[model samples]
Target: MKNLPQKVRSKKLSSRVDLTAMVSVSFLLIIFFMVAAELRKPKVMDLSLPYYDPKWDNIITCSIGVDNRIITVLLDDNNRIVTYSGLLFYPIESPKILSYGKNGIRKELEKRRKNILEYSASMGKPKNGPIIIIKPSKKSNFKNLVDILDEMAITKIDTYAIVNDFTPEEEKLLASK
Candidate 1:
């Protein structure tokens, strides 16, 4: 029996896992997450710009000046804002200097907002207040800017812009102050 030729037995090969489905599933999941992420963006504030009118004149301009402190300058039609009026193109009054906090700018803004609402009601027009122009000088500090913006939100005042230009009169006022 030892010298006789033995019959050869074939060995079975081990089966290998097909990873194509797993890879495809993984890719699909990655794509789904990427697309979903795009759809889940954070909400932001909505802003509506006014139509430019050549005749529209009475606009409120706020200037921020910093010289070891904060100075808030409110102007109407290039004149200072002593009172808040709903109409545009009003005459220039002496610009008022406002401090920060509850007793200062905040109070002034609240008063102005009240006046504006009242004026709008009397005029039988929508209570859309005047557009505010904000000019932040290089001397102004970050806190001052933040405070002004906060005051705007608190007063529910919209339609404001942060511009860099300063008129000659505004420059003179800053220098004098």
Candidate 2:
């Protein structure tokens, strides 16, 4: 009777495997790597950034004020207000800044580069390049800064810095010049 009348009982089980241990290991590895990795912030490795590098030690800075169409040339370590020159201005109604994007500004940038090269060469500097700092005014309205930024990006200029403050006379000088 035990061999012939034994009733079969079927037990159903789910096919999915329990991933608790695997998930625990994954989280543990993430924590391990996070703790093992360095804690310092990364620095950008390219472009016109002013570094302690002696090559750019005596670097020059220039400014384009919002009051008018004057480009100021700054000198010295203190970054003091220096002589301002140049008349590459466009009327406010039709400012020379590129519309939509920097395709137009690219050409202007080339001209500026050539002009800067000439100026640097005339000054007998080591290289004929534009290592310039652009300081646009706070009241700037033409949005030329955007185009300049786009141009800088396209030209791979990552090291450039911006100056934001200036004196009343600086504005006056910019306006008169």
- Identify the candidate with maximal lDDT: 1
Question: Global lDDT of each model?
Answer: 0.56, 0.47
What does candidate 1's lDDT look like per residue over 101-167, in tens digits? 7887678767655755665566554554645566666677666667678878987887567777876
Model 2: runs farther than 4 Å from truth?
1-105, 115-128, 141-144, 156-159, 167-169, 173-177
Tens digits of per-residue lDDT, candidate 2, 23-64, equal 999999998888767555465652333233344356432232
TM-score for candidate 2, please give it. Answer: 0.33
lDDT, model 2? 0.47
